[model samples]
Target chain A: MNEKKSSAGLKLCISDLSMSFGGVQALEGVSFEVEPGTIHAIIGPNGAGKTTLINCISGQFIPEGTMHFGERELTHVRAHNRIQMGIARTFQHVNVYSELSVLDNIMIGGHHRLKSNWIRQCLYWGPYGCSREEQMLQAEALELLERLEMRHLADSPAGELSYGQQKRLEVGRALLAHPKLLLLDEPMAGMAKQEKKQLSDWILDINREMNITIVMIEHDMTVVQTLSDQVVVLDFGRKIAEGPPQEVVKDKRVRKAYLGED
Target chain B: MEPNLTDKDAGTAAARPLLETRLERYGAVGLILALAVGSMLISSYHLSLLTTITIFAFSAMGLNLLSGNAGLISIAHAAFMGLGAFTAAWFAIDLGIPILIAIILAGIVSAGVGLLFGIPSLRLSGLYLILATFAAQIILYWFFEQALWLTKSPDGRFVGIPEVMGFEFGDPWHYYLLVLVFTIAGAVVYLNILRSGLGRSLEVIKERPIVSQMMGVNLQRTKLIAFTIGHFYAGVAGALYGWHLQFVATEAFDLMGSIELLVMIIIGGLGSLAGAVLGATFIVVVPELLDMAGRRLVDDMGLMAPIRMFIYGLLVVIFLIYEPHGLARTWRKLVRYFNKKLFKNKNEH
Candidate 1:
């Protein structure tokens, strides 16, 4: 079945983004560019401000930075508006609406795409359009569930899912937004080895099939080396290494940051 | 590779709506019919009780949506009702606006005022929303009491007997039917809204505002809309209430009224329209039944004031502890049990 997704990814450019909490500088003049339709992984140790950088790109932070998605400047765009511009993200922790059905939780990601006059929609008049819009959305969400091979679990509450499955649900929810740029904050964190491999494959599928640019923050070096086309390593709130995954792993500063000074 | 589920559970899954669609399809009609039957079969003596249940349910359904989906418990809901009743009464009585138009206008005006109070919901929720709306109730009641020109009398205000075309809804049965139509309309509208995109947003907003916002749902706007729609229902219900009693009194729409609506929604269930109706029925009918029993036992008109409050508090505790999802979840469980039991009995037969 043909999937209706956002037209291929946009160039995500982040420049001079510096954010600090009081004296605790989480990200300082951190800059990176993610080419369209590629997986760009950011690797860092504990408190390296990896998540902070992702948050900034996803409009969760207003750091001293200029962000450009395609031609649109997102320096001042709010979180919700960033999603409107096709920037969707998953949290570091799995954040599914536990009380909702699996399908219902995914459908929440598509609500902003609902385009109908608010007044007419409220009345539920057939010709007024929102009812029809929702029917189409339900079908779309169901199709997405089917593609994720989670069609049978559609009726079950999200809380009942295993931890790894919850992570996948969070990713599925993000995908439903038809994001041009997907920011995954620690997508592999806290997953079993097999689950990590499975999620890495799913991330690859999301990138290839949807033609979406992915900015993932991960600590799994093996998974990152295999999946990502490019890599940026951060240590102490600063970019220490940038190149192909294999080269970045061998960089002097990156090795020193991970293994301590030689 | 994924979690395993039994086939029996799959059957239940097939019966479920993604969210609120099934209720609109079957439950909404079933509720309206049951009330219609109640109107016919019940004694004219209890006709007023039936009418009051539907009227309260109209607004209770609104609170049901706000509290159930948005996770907002509004203590000022009754105050908004008071606002609508007064606005509709003022338009109809003072300015001589068409009564039906005035009622609709009253709903809009109440929504506007509710939006003002709902601003607090943007920064707060749960117990905090209750506190914020509590202040709203007190403030609105103060306005209702002090605005002598609106009521035309310092004591209370009276509205004319409602007339449409040549027919007058002066009789109890006629008034019941009129209120019934409005309540049914409210139910249908509530169902439709729930089955749509706005309903989806509220569901996510309730669970996690951060997730909803990340998905491009304007969190502030959605919460405000919940407040708006909830108050719109309160206003319409208040207008119908005004005509039902032929009076707009501050005492009727006080903290007690808001508490009563909250109790109805909680006891019935939060998210479902069916729960809202059942809750309204339980809250209204149980008390009146007790009142009747008390009257026969004591030979007194003032049978319950303090006693009723104690009962509501107790019932809320019982429901919250035993069936936290409220009566809707219980209703679903019963339906599922019967479906299996009846099928087994048929196979045996």
Candidate 2:
């Protein structure tokens, strides 16, 4: 495969990262590079360990090997700290603050970058003044909300949104973290065909407009075909195929893995 | 992503009442104002009871932050308060520290002890944490009773009255005002913290600690803060209670006292600050009211009146099962129901 040209000023390099729970190895000797400003897809059937790989990269597991975003080592980083390094992810299933307003859900993602101290916040008056910091954070959060076409539901509780809307809101939240690298786990899962189309368009828009390097795990072949700049297939926690979507889709092993035949 | 928000929805809509209510944080402020004004008008004895209720209410509010918001139940808050009371007494007696300064020091020292006990919470939870607090109550109660070098052994009455700023705090009225100021201020800070980012983080931890950790909220740090703050508030309340009565013993701050505070929160409402006040008032005043009713019944109808404690216990259980949302939710529903029935909107008509 050709070494793809980098564009979004980020190249995530993972080498020999492995993890095990008890005696069962979740991932072993997994190595891959997601080129900058491109959609790198990881596809697999049920229990193929796609989510585990995402978990490892997202700091949920302390892996045995190095995972680097640009030049910084991510193998030992905490999940939230990774956001500051421009790494963000959405769960395969929607994980969001249900009781909070849609706007506040985004604000939570923005909280990582907030500079306000507890002292200033507690007193309601301080040397730095919490009101000023709070207003600015709110402004930024509302801006991200509008971009995701969720401004109308800003005040609505996040749980009130439909599945598709919640998915969009999750994406909006990840964006609010100001990530240069976004890992979307099954962004198109459980969405209607039209909803999938809308989400796909937005994902592409984000990549094009904001130039975010997106590493997505998609089960839907149609989504992978339409959106990914490159594809990497995993099965039973092993890399099955890696290349452009057209090349990877035509591979015998890739077809057999998806179709369940040799 | 940088999303441009300035170009959209700048002034397109009227603010919803609910959203405005969140922004205004009217609940805490409104409750304090109403209670303060109401307290001033009551008879002096009731005013004293009101002061007790306020102190207990603030203590409950602190616990609510830890137990209700942060999902760490505590049964040892009263012990923390006891520590504060004795610390203040010891300081006032041995060091001759001013009452206000002593109270502050008591809160700080109690918070230090609270921090130590809270360390176990990093590894313990639920009934285990409750058990840990029970152990704390027993240990502290023993120390208060037996530690002669520090507390002068039983009958902890060596502590003198507190006077500060040239104003004697020995008077019931003076102490009541002092309690009122501190309780109101404590309630205000608690309300703000509940509405702030820390509140969200606590709720997040309560619902999903792993998710909260992944979201970048430090679980141990957040919980430590909750435990310390809760203990600090309880300590302040105890210190104030000690000085007001000018007499305190192990009996004043014991395991049953901790249980009573828990019952107050549970009966009033678990998560609502307003419920803390309602619960504290109910716990403090209802017994006296029942006693008066019992005496009247015996005098007029030739019946017994001393079964009030049994009735109070029954009320707690019934409320727990029947209206688990507590009196605050019930009160809200009643208000809303009357508002709808009494004042139908002209638009609806």
Q: Could you say which candidate leads in lDDT?
A: 1
Q: Could you give candidate 1's per-residue lDDT for residues B104-150 as a string of tens digits?
A: 99999999999888886689977887888889999998888888887
Compute the lDDT of residue B218 as modeled in candidate 1.
84
Return the lDDT, model 2, position B300: 51
**Per the 3 Å backbone cut-off, how many clashing residue pairs does candidate 2 have?**
0
Candidate 1: pairs in clash: none
- Binned by DockQ into CAPRI classes (incorrect, acceptable, medium, high), candidate 1 is acceptable
Interface root-mean-square deviation (Å) of every model: 8.2, 4.4
Per-residue lDDT tens digits for candidate 2, residues B1-349, read 3432332433333212211232123444576577667766889888878788888988888878778778788888888888888888888778888888989899999888888988977878878888888888888888888877656767676455568877776666667778888887787677666656676677777876765566667778888988888888888888888876776676878887898888888888876676788889899988778768777666653333336556767888899889986886786666556555655562121
Off by over 4 Å in 1: A1-8, B1-31, B293-303, B339-349
Once fitted onto the true fold, the runs of candidate 2 whose alpha carbons sit more than 4 angstroms away are A1-8, A126-128, B1-41, B293-323, B331-349
Q: Could you tell me the lDDT of residue A229 within candidate 2?
A: 88
- After TM-score superposition, what is the CA distance of residue A137 in candidate 2 from its true location, in Å? 1.4
Cα lDDT over the full model 2? 0.77
Candidate 2: tens digits of C-alpha lDDT, residues A47-160:
777899988887777889899899999987877678778888888888887877887777777667656566555554445535445556677777677777888898898989
Error of 1 at A163 (Å): 1.5
